[model samples]
Target chain A: MTRATLLTITAPTGTPAEGDAGFALADFDAPQVRITDLSVTRGDGVFETIAVIDGHPQALEPHLARLAHSAQLLDLPEPAAAVWREAVAAGVRDYRERNGEAGSGELFAKLIYTRGVEGSGRPSGWIFVDEGEDFSAQRRGIRVVTLDRGLRHDVAESAPWLLAGAKTLSYAVNRAAQREAVRRGADDVIFLSSDGYALEGPTSNVILLADGVVRTPQTDQGILAGTTQAAVFAFFEERGLATEYREITADELRDADALWLVSSVRMAAPVTDLDGREYPVDAELTAELNRYLLSRTE
Target chain B: MTRATLLTITAPTGTPAEGDAGFALADFDAPQVRITDLSVTRGDGVFETIAVIDGHPQALEPHLARLAHSAQLLDLPEPAAAVWREAVAAGVRDYRERNGEAGSGELFAKLIYTRGVEGSGRPSGWIFVDEGEDFSAQRRGIRVVTLDRGLRHDVAESAPWLLAGAKTLSYAVNRAAQREAVRRGADDVIFLSSDGYALEGPTSNVILLADGVVRTPQTDQGILAGTTQAAVFAFFEERGLATEYREITADELRDADALWLVSSVRMAAPVTDLDGREYPVDAELTAELNRYLLSRTE
Candidate 1:
């Protein structure tokens, strides 16, 4: 099935009106940024991806807060959240109208702001809405490899310039880790700090269920706080389950009753294997959590 | 002076012939990459910048080698260096022709290859030639701030997936460090490893002259090997000066007889002051090295 896409360009002076269906997904093209644009050239930018369900973006407030935080971390001008909200709204509305109701399974909304061309002093910003990937098969159960992230848990606190918590566009290393996992016959990777602490997955946050308690790595461990994880923890609290954020070691992950990689789109995925060792899949728990997540989003 | 830019797009099926000057610098624009493109959405790409003097790119061989190395580290298919060379040649030629002889200043030639939209398996490749910045004022002497890179010296060896040696487009952290340096009233930054090793600069490689020997951090310290530093060392070797590739501690950097940051475009910039500590300018040595670098390129 062809995924519908919507593009919205937001400039400082002239903001493109919303719901402009004049441009088709195939016809959408980005204006050529100067070759010197730091975003394109050096990956000097910050971005956020939100999941859209039934034409509404989920967890937008948290995402926007994180995006703003990322901008400040990178020393970029604070992005106008209101402008971004309008763009996301327009993009989703346009996508639904063009693709029709039958195409409304799920959509991925992306917001990007780049430090524009050198000396222009203008930041380039855009919003994109596209068809989301179907993760049903993998969400049932998946395999992950443990890879070293090559940094101590304290590095982020000691070095704010490392941009540990900010979701900047310099994701080459993260992508590389994912690629390596695929090559090794795993579905994803769980990155461990140099000192052997389980930090996070390449694109998701690591969650461990043990003794009826839900735990994830502390955000202070230099990992991007997962929005979905936050939502899930809130769900857990509402359901009267214990939730904790603390440093988790690689050994602790192996010893947990169940493991899941959580993200915005994938929601909660049970891990069937890690480093070729089989793990028990808590099918009942996975299903219950997925249902709760969907209901909350609705 | 307005910088001249030339853009060339190469696709899987079609290779745009060389010297196609039909496009103008002002009229050039990059077609919008699909929102699904990993390069744009995930910054999954590799790039190289070569110094162009009188329309000829300097240190082409080393830069190409490093690009290929970077591609390998990212698990990207090996790039066709010949194609990149052709694109560079065509871009330089077209840029010089359109900009006129009066625009004979230095140019920065860049090559980029991004893993294109997901599932297509096609890589997007391009070459850009644009006006270079004049470093005359800053080249005389500059101040630098020391920042922690937040990774130990041996992390790259333990974590290959971190892409430590690869010159990937994920440079947001590097740019942030430089921005912080500027905020601290410095011209650049020399990154120190978490373990207190003087690693490298945000963009350039750090070189220290002490006790009649020139020393730079070993590439194995998770740093990108600097082509310009290699060339300078070759020049030094030819001139009978001793050179060493070994770990230089942060304290050693402050104690060195002289320190310089070397890169493709900026060439060699002497560090006049580091962290508010002043050092004598080795004007004669800096001038002699620049002449050798330029003369060799010519």
Candidate 2:
């Protein structure tokens, strides 16, 4: 295993593998995909990133469910959850066993399933487990800016063809928005719909704290349902605070007492400033949330 | 070469190659891209497809210029046009030589330039020349349906981060619209902006003729500036017809005397029916236009 452990899904769908793990480990550093793969040529694919803490993949079931939902949205064949589940476990175990003490801390397993090479009528999938970037600075706090997502919040229901909420690989616009955020002297971005409603970030969900209650933009509004956000809500509920999901206006988001962008790998990163407005970061509470997030075994 | 000729651009940019074509012939069957390449993972890339007819690549310079323009929109390093131009020629020649008499008809050279493997500053470039699908039935006529693009027409100017006109690999939305069209009993689609303005098709440009004037939706409205549409205008201009570029409403498009979906591979595909309404197919005129389009030498 050269730094990372990679596996190509031999049986992405159909009956689960009994003796086998439904995948075959392959070279991680060598070229592994054809130039004509739809994922590369047309961005026709779905993906998920699962954070592995001490050989345990956090939110594994939710991530797999979202992957199936996204595949259905793209008209792709539903991936076999059992196969992917086993593949993720095998990938994490392989990476940990090969890296000795180096990989015991934090790692991410990325699962990519795509419409295969053109005209082949077959799908392709793979899982790669490797160390993730250090989010220490961003995990503490980061500056944020609001950018237009260029689609109405209702597009998910009105025009499903836009693939608003799917975790597809066609993320060029989302990547561009982050670049724009950097250009504007901010470290992150929260996208606002064309109809003037707060959505999610490029890769995370937005959460707000106000008036002793916690709120997040609903998943129906052309935004992804974050896996880490579920855990965050569980944290707040355990602390006796109320949590809700609804359509949030930009003005309401601005008036929140505290805010954070939560995702699978980075967990929770408190927002220190949104646009030009400053907010007080709840350092102690955020630290506790991250600590709880890292301690999840299943 | 195996059904196609593939070339890897070893030096995609910088000083142009003198002794070499700036590319190397590669195996078309082998996997050529890493799993982490941004093109596969994030759809962070731009591409262009040029038509090749009997050893001649039509509108090569214009296609290269558009490719450069799209790269600029994505903030990618400008591709050395001279290097790509030579690569296309080599790829076409190689394909023809390998296929002999079988490749005398129509071929396409697809130029793909991507933000290379993750964490590596180097970009990736490749060209593949292959025979296109037979378009005899589609050339006669295609049934089209209007679908919402879910973006305002002015997003190209107002929200550059949307990457509306850049022709990036993030084309899943466009692909989904075509699938939706098929579901609606149509063979193709013409996307309408959220503001009710006529826009381009999923893989082609929409051209309309009415009252002796040839018109197309202006490219500034978040639509690709079409290379084939330019040649279509030239065909009409030679026959003493005026051509115009302006924002066209959906009603105007529906009432046109004639319409076509022009593209690189298919050239000119006449539209006979739109949204259950019928238009008389001008087979002779469409055939003449395609002949002229195929006759371009440069």
TM-score of chain B of each: 0.91, 0.98
Question: After best superposition, candidate 1 residue B236: deviation in angstroms?
Answer: 2.0
The reply for model 1, stretches above 4 Å from the true place, is A12-26, A29-35, B1-3, B11-35
**Model 1 interface CAPRI class:** medium
lDDT at residue A194 of model 1 (Cα atoms): 79
Candidate 1 local Cα displacement, residue B41, angstroms? 1.5
Error of 2 at A24 (Å): 0.7
- Interface RMSD for each candidate model? 2.6, 0.6
Error of 2 at A282 (Å): 1.2
lDDT of 1 by residue, B1-298 (tens): 4545655455422444576432223344454344556665677888899998877799998998898888888877777776677667877887887788744777878887777666778776667787778798667899999998877888788778888878888888898898889889999999998789999998899989899998999999889999999988988888898999999899998999899999998888999999999989879888888777665563
Worst 10 residues of 2 chain B by lDDT: B13-22
Q: Whole-model Cα lDDT per candidate?
A: 0.80, 0.92
Prediction RMSDs, each to the true structure: 3.1, 1.4
